[model samples]
Target: MDKIMMWVMAICALIGGVDQLAGNKFGLGRRFEDGFQLLGPTALSMAGLICITPLLSLGLEHTIVPLYRILHLDPGMLGGVLAIDMGGYQLCKELAQDPAIGRYGGIIVGATLGCTITFTIPVGMGMLGEREKPLFAKGILAGLCMHPVGILTGGLMCGVSLGKLLFQSIPVLILAILLVFGISRFPDGMIHGFRIFATVIRSAGTIGIALGAFSYMTGLQLLPGLTPLDEALKVVSSIGIVLLGSLPFAEILQRLLKNPLEWIGEKIGLGRNGTAGLLVGIVSALPVIADMKRMNEREIVMNAALLVCGTSMVAAHLGFVLGVDAPATGALLAGKLTGGIAGVWMAWRIMK
Candidate 1:
């Protein structure tokens, strides 16, 4: 019964795709209405959010190590440099810029030039007077998630300190600023480019989901050494996990958050722009993100967003992998929390 319920939700959610063709409320109805659009970017972006980051990292690791061994170089140290602009991280960053039509980008990079650089930057910047500026909340959410989230988290298990991890992100942080500047130069051609890329990526993802689900249901493992089929299953099922894990719980979480968030708003004079939803969004940032209405929240929303920049589940999950009793998890969580608060405050001051 539990499994049936879960599958039913998965089928509905997966088929729903973002909140366009389906979903109810502002996004509160039956999301599986236009089944035709299911094979579109929304579905792919959803799957890419979880799967693309991990698979990209996984594939790169496999490729780099093999090449390193052949060339007699350092195994782990001699890795790859990847600059990918497709997937949930990138796609969402692009979509959030302008819903009716816009171009947004999320970037993840890990390159070693006598040193290692692991960087992820989310952009919400728009052209001056263009009516579409990337929100700090959207940027923060993108930074903290996607495929690279796994690599940064995995670093913790390998004894990398949070400080060291943050240091590596510095380069990407600089690049991210430039990325925002670059996005402000958008034109008609870019939108077309985005759609074309999105279609290709989504088509690949949707097919992977179908193939992967079939393999799982029938207990078949076609690929022996590599994981072409396994990878497909992993990506699709990951989308299911996100939908199952985040959506249903969001309602309950939102209810619990109302009073506390309202109190904070009153105290801070957060006005109509309060970002309590961003905090509530802690459970599943993407869903809360999808539900955001730019017209309502203004300064306070931006403040809330800038406040929580560069923080996410990836950062905290690393600690758990260190063991519940381990000091690393607790330490990292505390650091990120404190840093997030301070960052938000500073951002408010500077942007003001």
Candidate 2:
């Protein structure tokens, strides 16, 4: 089922890319508006359990578990992830505004936040045990987590009242729609906010896991207030890992994928390589031709075509090597490679 959904998402990306290449506009009345339309649904739906089920566990812990035995607070988990996504978004946005950093901040921040926030839902859901419950509790929990205090702060700056705006049931529904739609229409906007948050919080789960392993290995307890220095060091280490490790990892992938067409040209016959390359380059390069940074739609087809061939070949090669034969793998690889190229292109675009 998971694999099936993955393929579905890939297909949507392919279709969307093709549409952009053909100069077709989505019903949303914007060229880039449909960018996330399909993938967002699959991600959110698959992550539904995570967003809602935690509330069930929280409720059960308070009602059933002995006070002395209650070891965890679910709110902290929800709030923490929300906070991380928020912090990463803010940090990236700030760096993007800097002349020295500019768009470099945006890519690092956006990718980290985007991947984390989207990945969190599924990861959280998987951590749960079977227990079905009412939707009200889930809805309320989802609202709170989705609109953490920091998100509200930013929304307020944009004239959106996170509390009052999201409290009403109708408004909540509207916000849900917007959240999904906004993902597609302005993926970077969503990522911008999430990245800043992720960077800030750095994810408590990640910290907890690290601390647990460290404690086991060094025979040191990880209790709070016991070692402030240790906690601070851990935080610093995580930050360094993200900045030096994660960012560089992405860069390495980009470098590895460079001249993907040339790689395919070497592997496959030239004719097959050329056809595949043309299709991918046309689709993948839309962001460039569309002038996505400032938001323009003209010249997108030609520019996107070039990018698609060059980068989509990377995805195809990735799929080939991974033995990914599903239609979805094709779509995902196509989208992933395109995204990588888009990131590099955006970086170059901003640099110039």
Error of 2 at 3 (Å): 24
Number of the top-ranking candidate, with lDDT as the measure? 1
Q: In order, what lDDT does every prediction score?
A: 0.36, 0.31
Candidate 2 worst ten-residue window by lDDT: 131-140
True-vs-predicted CA distance for residue 337, candidate 1, Å: 4.9
Structural similarity to truth (TM-score) of each candidate: 0.45, 0.24
**lDDT tens per residue, model 2, 69-98:** 343211111121221222222232232223
| Candidate 1 local lDDT, residue 247 | 42
lDDT of 1 by residue, 32-79 (tens): 332233224333433433333444445645675466445443232221
